[model samples]
Target chain A: MSSVLRFRDLTLGYDRHPAVHHLAGEIERGALLAVCGPNGAGKSTLLKGIAGVLRPIGGRIERMGCEPRQIAYLPQAADIDRSFPISVFDMVAMGHWRSMGLFGGLGQARKLKVFDAIAAVGLTGFEDRSIGTLSGGQMQRMLFARLLLQDAPVILLDEPFTAIDARTMADLVDIVKRWHGENRTVIAVLHDFEMVREHFPQTLLLAREKVAWGDTRETLSAENLLRARRIVEAFDREALECTRAA
Target chain B: MYDYLIAPFSEFEFMRRALVGSIALSLAGAPVGVFLMLRRMSLTGDAMAHAILPGAAIGYLLAGLSLGAMTAGGLIAGVLVALAAGAVARFTALREDASLAAFYLISLALGVTIVSLRGSNVDLLHLLFGSVLALDEATLLLLAVISTATLVIFAALYRPLVLETLDPGYLASVSGAGAPTQLVFLCLVVLNLVGGFHALGTLMAVGLMMLPAASARLWAEDVTAAIAIAMGMGVVASYAGLVLSYHAGVPSGPVIILVCGAFYILSLFFGRASGLIRLFSGRQHLEA
Candidate 1:
């Protein structure tokens, strides 16, 4: 089979101005790609472009041979407004909305899908829990549950583990490995170098441009490493190193 | 007191008109009120309600035709102001509440000017204050038609509306569900204002529409349950308002508003979310 996603000379932005420029790449079917960059280096922009949220300004995005409903997204947990009074079940069930009629008259079949998704995310007893009651890790898992119900072969995740604790990161890595085992295509934006080295086989290092991209071993060059840490050099490193050691 | 309560519905057709029309308006106002709370567009309801004054006067100028004509004119005008306010809020740096307030003030002034231009000083007072007891058969029919149509449309567009109201940004970008949500919601608000104009008057229409639904939120944990309870409370307020107005011979609109206000007070004391009961109970747990 051909690559599941193709980005050729791609440019994307909101409001007719390009946020990301001239990105050319392709993802083999079932590839696990990690996109790493400093904040506002257009990492989210690239994700949005691929997901069809922001229109690509310059080039074509050929997402070959996948139905619209066959794409799932796990956005940052903070992105969801918690003040809304929807329960965990309510949020998970929404992934089936495209199949549900416009009015969402729920049926036995769709409900089974939602239950299966919740089980897959390991939130077996949280079906009736309010979103406000969830801890950060639980919220992340709930988002995965929603995406699981989508039953898509491709998943785009934006900062799926940031701000959450280390346990959350481990839980998320476990989920990613599960997806990898299933041979599903996974694209995630991250900031951790350790996890990229440990789990993901491919990495895309970015700095408002594609600095380097290849297998993890190829991308760990001293030049790429220096470029990734360049933004942190302006700060005092003495106390920072001490703090890191502690 | 007994005679006043029993005799109105017992004998007078005008009294029956007022009571029947009030029931329809309150029932219809519930769903629109629930959405306004969720969307944080409560102030838009306020702006549209008052903005119809000049249109009501223009409606009065064309008033010789029928109640239907007058109401249609007012609905078109209310929707125009709501759209203008909505567009400016979305497209500019101005806060939506401030934009709504500006529209409301300007529309209120213009409505007064139109009434002066029509130059019927006494009739203008009746429009502002309302005379529910003076309603006729035709006005009641218009209320019925508007209320029924508004409720039906709300039931049809329920989920997308709730989804967009809770999270417009994601719905707009990733999902593109915001467009349909905005259209259905504002349209329903205008429909309620049109029906409400007959009984509560423009000055008080939104107060009746909002106060009960707002209070209902403190007690509800989900959208579906909130709507059901709000509709029931709204119908109860309608019945109670008419009964009190008959026995007390007071203004029907204000009586209904006062009853709804009382419900708000009760909710603040006993409702679940932020009620005083929750506060004291929480304090007890902390101390323990």
Candidate 2:
């Protein structure tokens, strides 16, 4: 399969303290990749780097055809303000922003697409409800609906299922599988290894840097998992930078 | 009842001018205020109001209270302070509110010094508290124009503005609308405060903007309804305050703000959305 995203010695961090350091890989097109790591292993940071929200401290990220903005991204639910007085329909309709520009109205065709997306997420009757009133599962469903409307070639989800109920998780996983089936490259930062092993075919295990990258089964082997855990647990705040260069 | 409520506006031209100026302020300021409150920038709005004082004072000093000079001066000063504070917050360790507080404090001192240098206490009072009852034709015209411009811009940028307010990070990730939208919204805030300063003065201008907005939050469930309710509250406060001030010999600006405060207090207790009473009374449990 052809690669859609290439990360060449990418080092991403905040305040010059590298959280994701000297990573290198290519994400193949139509790959369902699950990025698994312990807490603070730069999993979310890596996704942010790929999504173009965080600038790399070193090296480069190369996308095949589309611009970084064209990639559909769903940040953590905590990043969104749930108390804003917006309805589900209006919130979901914002997914049409790429085609609509700033001032375009949701005409008949786009409106129908929005309705279809909402219904696909099983939130058909909750269109008029305020987002602030939505439970955690319902809110996640709404976000998935918006993601459906985004319809990008590459999608990045940063901990999309955190705090979501099991039913909602199952439904959202189906949508993710549907995207993979449509030949869209999807990279997700996930914690649930059981779900990852069951669904994702490709795996990238990271602990601040690449521990292993390959097929899900071998990459998630007991040895690799133990190595990743040791690398994270033994991380030193005052350690010198690695002299190894890619 | 007619003589008490409606006679003063019909009988006196100053009352009429104050009423018109205030209504224009309500029309624009309310929606802006609602957005501000939603963004949790009500304090920033207050700071920007104070930040305009030095500019208006400088204008007063330069041209001796000409409406055009003061308005221009206030706009330039307010925008400068806002940009300065914003830049400081973005590129430095200081938070936005901290930088804003520092800038507005210095600005207030500079404004008070400038005004006190060339004018009497009455002039100072007029600048600080405004002379809404004495609005001239030019000032009234300026208020109308500002209100009209504010409404048009708000409508045009409504979608992006809502998205920006709701999920700024998402908006940033999706499109290039975040920074420009934020900048334009700040400019609108400064503009409304500058316009409001003509009738409500520097200190009380933000009251006209934020109080009605805070009250509206309790009563409305969505942005559109919140903005409408905020505007309605502001207009009512303006009219009632003017009538009360005319009869009670009180200042109209503070009275107008007090009326807004009254609405806020009432809404806190009895509003339908999430009022104190509603929280206490509770609704029936919904079936799964």
**TM-scores, chain A, per candidate:** 0.84, 0.97
Off by over 4 Å in 1: A14-17, A67-69, A77-79, A228-246, B1-7, B64-66, B169-175, B282-288
Docking class of 2: medium
Tens-place lDDT per residue, model 2, A17-113, is 7889899989999999999988989998998888898999899999999898999998865467789998899899989989998778799999999
lDDT of 2 by residue, B1-288 (tens): 999999998999999999999999998999999999999999999999999999999899999989989999999999999999989999999999999999999999999999999989999999899989999999999999999999999998788888888988789878888888888999999999999898889999898899999999999999999999999999999999999989999989999999999999999999988899998986787796
Top-scoring candidate (lDDT): 2
lDDT of 1 by residue, A1-246 (tens): 579988887777555544565778888889899998777567888877677766777776888777433567665543566877789998888777656747666788888888888887778889998888898788888888777766678888988988778876786688788888898999999888788888999998866557788998688667886785574343332432112110
Alpha-carbon deviation at B78 in model 1, angstroms: 1.5
Worst 10 residues of 1 chain A by lDDT: A237-246
